[model samples]
Target chain A: MPAALHALKDFSDIHINLVGNQALIEAELASKSFDKNRLSITHAEQVVDMDELPSKALRNKRQSSMRLAVNLVKDDVAQACVSAGNTGALMAISKFVLKTIPGIDRPAICTSMPTMKGHVHVLDLGANVGSEGESLAQFAVMGSVLAKAIDGNPKPRIGLLNIGEEEIKGHQRIKDANSLLKLIDINYIGYVEGDDIYKGNVDVVSCDGFDGNIALKASEGVAKMIGFYLKAAFNRNLFTKFIGLLSYPVLKAFKEKVDPRRYNGASFLGLRKIVIKSHGGADAFSFFHAIAEARLEVQKNVPALIAQEVATLLTPQVIEATHNEI
Target chain B: MPAALHALKDFSDIHINLVGNQALIEAELASKSFDKNRLSITHAEQVVDMDELPSKALRNKRQSSMRLAVNLVKDDVAQACVSAGNTGALMAISKFVLKTIPGIDRPAICTSMPTMKGHVHVLDLGANVGSEGESLAQFAVMGSVLAKAIDGNPKPRIGLLNIGEEEIKGHQRIKDANSLLKLIDINYIGYVEGDDIYKGNVDVVSCDGFDGNIALKASEGVAKMIGFYLKAAFNRNLFTKFIGLLSYPVLKAFKEKVDPRRYNGASFLGLRKIVIKSHGGADAFSFFHAIAEARLEVQKNVPALIAQEVATLLTPQVIEATHNEI
Candidate 1:
């Protein structure tokens, strides 16, 4: 809130969508004591319950905070919408409001997951489960664009998540999708194993949301579990404690470096507008970082670039098919 | 060789089909200094190549090491077979040599992977990549039995791996398998997440080999990558070094506790004869451990128990009703 307020301090054409209790939102804004003329705060009448039944949260969208945020983007009150609420609901409203870009089938929530080597961006982790072949191909395209915009790579090497490195691997749907991606001239690196997710061998990792979510959760749970055991082991004996003393700097460096909070922003690619889905458990700092990402994405015109690329890639195929069909 | 020879010296009438190079087998037997009458070492003309094509490894009727191992069990030349070669080949040979246990459609491989919390015994890691409804149900039944016999669970809780936890969740195959498991009252635990494998939340985690292999590799890769970074970090600076010093003993204890050597045996579960498939990269110790497990399973008559239980479970349903017909 402070960062947004500060950014709008000298601007006359800025407003904020404070999606929560009316009085609380106003009071929080008042406490900030920024240029009142430059900023306007609109309290959202309803907020989606952030819970396991994330899909249900969007049902009461008439007064939902997420709906209001989408409305701001739709109404041109804001160039981009940002939310740290229920991701499912945010994706829901974004689809309903902003709509997918032309030549794009479905929008993908793309996030850069940090690896030991560096970073790898994976799409559709929580946005869409049980993806169709066409949609997966679309995710690959959007993920490549996102990586490029982030300066991770000019044409990020894209990998389809599979059990093996063989061409004839993966589920039937993924197999069909592999053929579709081959038609495009993208930098498509073939099948990648789960180990590749962290090995940093590929920049863009794409999979159905079900597997992606499972992979992300499994990775996170294992890390936490390892930390727990490591902590327990450190307290085992005096001799080991002495050894740990010698290794203290290394362990501390690792913990600080691998912290998830360092990369809190997740971009919803392939939308007509740029939207960043922040972590549900994000703090003020993370929320600010997400907002910052939304600003950069909007500035970079990532959606427009993706739209252009998708059209270029698909138009020829579509035209050839139309000719062949005729 | 030494341990078996020592046992042979103490307990008479142990027959050994010593396959591979005659000189090496003779030297090993001679070094053990066992009574010549107690240890009968018959040299086999051939050994199974680890890199042989699966067809050659699987279909070769010649006395290939793998085939010889299976033949020993089949012909009562040896009580069981233990091999630390190609797993796919072992599964194939086990099936071809021993035949499937009555009422079991396909063979499943059960391996115990050390999770962050405790141990998770996972099934069908590679044996059956594309399992059918009946095959999965059979796997569930067999896994439950193995858990009870080996892991010492009175009634092992079995979970079907799926995209969701609800009974109504998952693809058609899982739904059919779930219905079958429920009908038989096989201690079914509905569905489980990928992380559940490491969280030790489920006793037996069953999945198609594709996802199972991916999940296993993902866990292994993440732990290793983090360990690598942590080591690098420990050497970075001084203050972090203090934290590492504080945490050494507990981590070492944790590492020792989860080392794969403790649970190195993987059983090819649907065969009529006992076949323990050791890791291809296993050393002499792991191979010997696999042998011990195979011996135990043979002595306990696990295959017979599985066949009996599975037959009892399926008897209630019409034998004429096929999966496709359903």
Candidate 2:
């Protein structure tokens, strides 16, 4: 908490409102044991418990902390809303309040995870489940926009996550989306396997929310597992521990790169305004990171750029990419 | 090359008769530096190139290395066949030579990967792309048999990899498989997600080859990336490199634990005889691991056990698990 506060303190001009019970908020502040002169903490609705899913949490939208945070964006009180709350509820409230950006039928939750080469962003991680081909195409466009906003790579290469690199492979929906992406001339790089996600063959990976969510979490689980085993190996004995000391700097650096806190939030792409959905289990430091990401998206004007580009592509919506005849 | 040769020394009794051009074999042998005692190099038909996909390579079956390997398995010259070559070609040839075990429609390839808690074995990673409900049920039965064979568990808990943990949430095929699995005495734990692959929620995960392959490789990619960054971080500078020394033992231990070689081959389940399909890019160590796993499976008599146990449940081979429900 102190580290998060310190990091946020360096950038004091950024507005932040703390939403929850007065007692919990005060408890968090009092425990900090440091002066809070530079921080802006305002009261909003109480947060819904993390245990609750979006379907159930959204029922109390009027008083939910997530609803209140998203409402801030809706009311223009904040340029972008950031939260480490129920992602599903956050998506619902943001869609209801802020509305989808022009030309985007559904919003995508785009999150970043560590890749072998560097950081890569995947979209529709869990925003909408059971997605169709058109929705996947929308995710590709939105992910490309987010990648450019975060990484500054214009015309980012897009890869449809599939079983194989061939166009004929994958589920029916993926095949349809592949054909569509190819005809659009949007730097489509054909299909990529699951391994490509870590290899960084493409800048943006797009998939349905369910599969994307599974992939992201699975990757995290695998990384953490590897880290655990590495520590065990280092701690094997006195001699191994001595070797561990020698390898400490490299391991720490690797952990830092793989840490999710560095890239904390998944922007709810297609929203009229930037709406970043932080992981529900995130702590103060993670929330701080989410706010930082939100600041970047706001400054980059990602939503406007995406709206402009996708609109041009959709005017004719050239379905010729299928090339079924060829 | 020396390390591989030393490892091969442990299995010196095994003789590899390379029935190909003697001069070419000798030249290739010189390049690999494989110990002559462990393998008797000979000359015979050509081997299949690993680079080509099965659809094209399977056309000329007689000359393919994969076909030759399968013939060796059938002729009792080798206890098992391992191939890092094209998966489809290997499967096609193995099916033709070994044939499917009774009550099994087709063979499925199963492999284990490191996870947060331990390791997970998922089947049909890429053998059969479009599996039906009954096929998946067979996979579930076969996967459990294979898992028990290697893990030594009495009844390995089996799971269906789907979008959700709920039985009814997945596609129709899964819904049908769920019902069938529920009726059996096997420890069917219902559905699992991609994340569960590493969470250690289930011992055996069964899915269509397409999704399974994508998920498996994606996890591998993430692990490799983490290992890469950790190395870089340790090598940052003199001071951090000192810390890197401290962490080296643990990190290396983790890498070893998670190394794919430790779980090299994916068993061709549902086949009449045990056949392990090694990764196309597998090194000598990985090939050796595949041999080890195949030996374990053979000793366990997994095919006979599965044939006996599932005979009744499948005898009335319910067309669909859904029918069992009605």
Question: Which candidate leads in TM-score?
Answer: 2
Model 2 chain B worst lDDT window (10 residues): B163-172
Per-residue lDDT of A1-326 in model 1, one digit per residue for the tens? 66466545533444555556678877777666776665666677777876524445556655777788788888878788878876767777788779999988778878887776688888877567567777788888888888888764777899988875232256776775677777776899977778788887889888877667667766776777788777667656787667666665566667776777767788888889877887777776666667667777877789888998888876657535533443
Query: Among these predicted structures, which one has the highest DockQ?
Result: 2
Task: List residue ranges in candidate 1 displaced over 4 A.
Answer: A1-16, A27-40, A51-59, A126-132, A165-168, A237-249, A284-289, A315-326, B1-18, B23-53, B130-132, B164-169, B237-250, B284-289, B316-326
lDDT of 2 by residue, B204-240 (tens): 9988787687777778788777767766776678877
Candidate 2 on A112-140: residue-level lDDT in tens?
87676677788877666657776788888
Clashes per candidate, residues 3 or more apart or on different chains: 15, 37
Please give, as one word, the docking class of candidate 1.
acceptable
Residue-wise lDDT of candidate 1 within B61-155, one digit each (tens)? Answer: 36676777678789977777777776766777778878998888788888887665567678877666567767788888888888788768897
Where does candidate 2 chain A have its weakest 10-residue lDDT segment? A317-326
Off by over 4 Å in 2: A1-8, A26-53, A165-168, A242-250, A320-326, B1-23, B26-44, B74-79, B115-118, B163-172, B238-252, B315-321, B324-326
